[model samples]
Target: MKDLIKDVHENGVKSDYKEPKLYDVVPKEEIAEFEEVMREIIADIVSEASDVACWVYVQKYVKHKPLDDMLQEWSEASQFILAMDTWFERLMAD
Candidate 1:
C-alpha cells in the first residue's frame, strides 16, 4: 500500500485529475504528542482484548475443553490481535 502511494506520487499516473495538497489537521509541533496519545489508546484496547482472551482460556480449561475447542479459541485470539496490529499500522501510516 505504501509502495502504491509512493508510485502514484512519483510516477504521475495517467489521470487527468490533480490531487489536492493534503494539509496536516494537527499542527506539526503537536504531531508527536498526538501520536503518543493514539498509541496509548491503541495499547489500552489491545491490553483489554488480551485480558479477555486470557479469561476465556481460563474458563475453557476450568470446563475441561477438548483440544479442538482450545485450538479454536487460540486461533481466534491470535486473529484478533493480528487485526488490531494491522489496523494500527495502517492508521499510523496514514
Candidate 2:
C-alpha cells in the first residue's frame, strides 16, 4: 500500500514538472502546446533577442508571477525545452 502511494506521488510529480498545471486539464494538448512554444522560446534565447520572453510566458500561463528572477526562470524554461527534446527523441525512436 505504501509503495502504491509512493508510485502515485512520483507519477504526479513527473507530470507537474513537464507540462505544469495545465497538464491536468488536458495533458496531451498541453504538452503539445508547450513543445510548440518552447521552440520559439529557445530561438529567442539562442538569438539573444530578449530574455524577457521567458518571463512573458510564465506571467501569462503560470499563476503566481515571480518578479524577474532571470536565473531561475531561464533555468526552468531551459530544462523544459531539454525535457521536450528528450521526449521527442524517444517518441521518434518508437
Which candidate number would show the highest lDDT if scored against the true structure? 1
Error of 1 at 34 (Å): 0.4
Q: Which stretches of candidate 1 lie over 4 Å from their true place?
A: 1-23, 64-94
lDDT of each: 0.63, 0.56
Q: Write the per-residue lDDT of candidate 2 for residues 40-88, one digit (tens) a residue.
A: 8899776653444444444534744443443355665665544444454
lDDT of 2 at 52: 48
Give TM per candidate: 0.42, 0.25
Score candidate 1 by lDDT.
0.63
Error (Å) of candidate 2 at residue 36 is 0.8
Among all candidates shown, the one with the greatest TM-score: 1
